[model samples]
Target: MTRLAGMMAKSAVAPLDRLKILMQSNCPHYSRFNLWSCYRAVLNKEGFLSFYKGNGAAMIRVFPYAAIQYTAYELFRPLMRALMGPHSHIGNFTAGAAAGTVAVTSTYPLDIVRTRLAFQVKGEHVYYGIMNALQKMFHENGWRAYYKGYAATVAGILPYSGSSFYFFDLSKRIMLKYFPKQTTTVNEEKGGRLELSIWAKLICGCLSGVIAQTAAYPVDVIRRRMQLIGMHPAYDHYNTAMWRVGVIVYHEEGMSAFYRGLSLNYVRAIPMVGISFTAFEFFKQLLRIEEHAPTS
Candidate 1:
């Protein structure tokens, strides 16, 4: 259920997701970095279907990614709650950060493939498909290539996941406080839990996603740059890729380099997160997962 929800959420914003990757990777063809201009460029060059170029790989990667993430969160949340007590904000953040780290570490290779596949432009196809791309990467750079930007990804995921869960829990608390009637109490075997309206859940999810994505946007750009170390000319230093790319982006492109595709990220993330969390919660209810405070 979590996997299906994640696929549906990502599929809805797959086009924008590709656009964000293109813009962030500093595609050579585009003179500027506006969403509409990039959209038009992709449309003119590769036609409409181009937007979904790497979506197949994305789905394959995201299914296990989402399953691991949500499952890890569920496991960690209860442990944290036991240690930190009920409704601990720190517990929520810690659980989320840990879950994200576990998920990314487990699924980082597919992410590299997904990015490489998405970065391919019309008439410049470097990879034939997912398996071919993986084979080439293995033969060329060996196993290390799969974890090119591991440090950067872990760094970014820490705050990205922490703040996302923190803000989501905070938003729910605020909503329930201000609009008590919109929430109901569910009597579980352990205790009574606050159940929010679907509207509240969606709003909280959207706002949390925007805030967390924005906060970690620069790190995300750096992670992408590092991940493309062998593929991109500017990021050729594989051994010292993370710091080297950071220095290059800072010195060569100034501060804005780290925020190249932020707008598109927000565009993709808002609805994706809104739908993801809402769907997860809906599925949880249907599956009879306990609807307690700090619901994973």
Candidate 2:
């Protein structure tokens, strides 16, 4: 159910997702493009379907990613709460970071494939399909290539996932505090839990996404840049170290390099997180899962 919800939410923002990747990539050809210009370029060059270039890989990758993320969160949350107590935000943050790390480690290769596919021009296809992309990456650099930037990704996701879940849980509590009537009580066999209204869930998700994405975006940019090493012509000589990539981006493009696609990310993230949390919560309700806890 979490996987389905993730796929649906991702599909809703597929075009923007592609755009965000393109904007974030270290490819020199796309350096001048913004969201609208990139959209126009894709449309004119590859037609409408171009917007979904890597969505197949995205869906395939996201299923496991989301499944592991949510599952790990659930498993870790109770442990964290037991360790840090129920009201501590550190529990939520730690759980989220652990969940993100586990999920990313399990599914990092597919992300490289997705980015490679998305970065391709319409007729200038570097990879014909997912399998071909995998084959090419393997043949080019062996298994290590798949795990390129992996440490950076884990590092980035620590803050991204930690802050996202932390803020979401925090915001939900605030909303429930201010609008107590909007909260619904769920009677579980063990204990009762409060569920926020759909609107509150959406609001919490969006705000959390924005804050988290903004905070961790520079690391994300560095991760993307490192992932493109050996893949993008501009980064052909680049190493996979996070600090090295950060240095290069800063030296060549200045500070703004770290925030390349942040605006597009914000645009995509709000709706993406909103839909993801709302769908997950809705599904939990439908399936009668415990809802009082933070299930982000």
Candidate 3:
């Protein structure tokens, strides 16, 4: 029957659709484009492939992290605006902060895994899966390990997201101010000039990511060190004090230790932030969300 044949085709395509999503999710094209490039260069000192050490697990983590991050930003932001008034910077900041927190929380476990995987070298003990990583952490250091460096993650993401939302919003305003005609063109075709060019939005997002990342870099370093604490046998004594950990690293490996993987971090940051911001901007526009002019 025609109906039976249609159902068969749908079933055959379902797996392909899932596979496409999985590949798209796992691709490090964004990471490779940004901070990961730096990370890779650093890894080249060790070996060519060192840059991708924990990449398999990291890819898995990215799927959820990206989805949760974008979804939370989109879904929670407007609800925040509705409740707090559209033009309030306070509201925007709070919404952004909450969205960052929620997205990070949803994806923290995977982040922990990704960090663990990235830090892994050949012959290093590696986690098998998410549940295995959780079990291993709990078995070794109690439940606290799952949340290790979580404070730093929160500290970093809060400003990162807040600035991202704030600056991206501002950039569009500036773009509109400079190119009023674009708005008219956009309005004619895509509803309004407020729609913004894809390129403009990308530039705004990339700049925002840089500013936000700069502000939060130290916390990010702390977060990564904290996440890697339990993985290394020598670092077992890493206490909760961020400065203390830095001191110990300095004492052990001198100043260079603290910055061991910084190149990789930068490599991962640039493009990741660029893509993330671009994605956020595009999604926001796709949803027809208007940027409320910030009141100074």
Candidate 4:
């Protein structure tokens, strides 16, 4: 269900995701245009299907990524509770961070392939397909190439995942406290677990995503540059050291470079997180998944 939700949400925003990556990676062509102009340019040059260039890889990566993160979160929750008794918020943040770290680390190779595939333009291309990309990367740069931006990814994901789960849980508590009617109980007699209304859940989920994305957007930009540094001349100069990448972008492009493509990120993230959070819960209840769990 979590995988399904991620796929549905991610597929819906693939175009925006690609556009953001283009700008974030400082692609010579697409980065030169504004949002509307970039969209039109891609459509005119590469056709509509170009928007989904790497979506196949994304879907493949996201399925296992979502499954691992959500499952790890659930499995780790009880351990966190035991470790951090009376500090539920802290537990939630740590559990989410751990889950995110595990998921990203596991699926990182595919992430590299997905970025390389998406970073390619119509005429100027490095990789033709998923298998080609994987083969070329390994043959040219060896296995370590797949984890080029691993440090940046983990650095960004810590705060992103921590705040994401924390804020969602916080929002639900607020809703139950002030907007009491907006939530209900599944096993009121036994579990006493509160299930938020769909609308309330969506609001919390979207808001949490926006907050988490903002907090981690800069590292995300760095990660994109690192991931695609060898793919094109535009980003290739940044292929020195990971810290040097940050220093160069800051010194040359100014602080704004760290936030490149952030506006489009918010536009893409809201619906994606909303759907993932809301749809996951809906399916969980429908399938009676994790019914033994204390909360949704």
Q: Which candidate should be chosen as best, given lDDT against the real structure?
A: 4
Clashing pairs in 1: none
For candidate 3, write residues 173-240 as lDDT tens digits: 77777765653235554544345566666677677767776666556666666776767654466655
How much is the lDDT of residue 114 in candidate 4? 87
Name the TM-score of candidate 2.
0.91
> Where does model 3 exceed 4 Å of error?
1-47, 79-84, 126-132, 181-185, 189-194, 242-267, 287-296
Query: Model 2: per-residue lDDT, tens digit, 1-296?
Result: 66777788788888988887777775565678776887887788788888888799889988788879988998998899999998888998999999989999999999988888888886678799999999989998999889878878888999999998899888876766666666544446436556677887898899999999998898887777777777767777568467877888789889987887788888889988888877777787777774464443
lDDT of 1: 0.82
Residue ranges of candidate 4 with Cα displaced over 4 Å: 183-194, 284-296
TM-score of each: 0.91, 0.91, 0.70, 0.91
Range of the 10 consecutive residues with the lowest summed lDDT in candidate 2? 183-192
- The residue ranges of model 2 lying beyond 4 angstroms of the native Cα positions read 182-194, 291-296
lDDT of 1 by residue, 19-43 (tens): 8888777777763748788889889
**lDDT of the structure predicted as candidate 4:** 0.84
lDDT of 2 at 182: 65
Candidates 2 and 3 compared by TM-score, better number: 2
Worst 10 residues of 3 by lDDT: 18-27
Tens digit per residue, CA lDDT, model 4, 126-203:
898899998888887898888989999999999999899789777877777777664655456446666666888899
TM-score-best of 1 and 3: 1
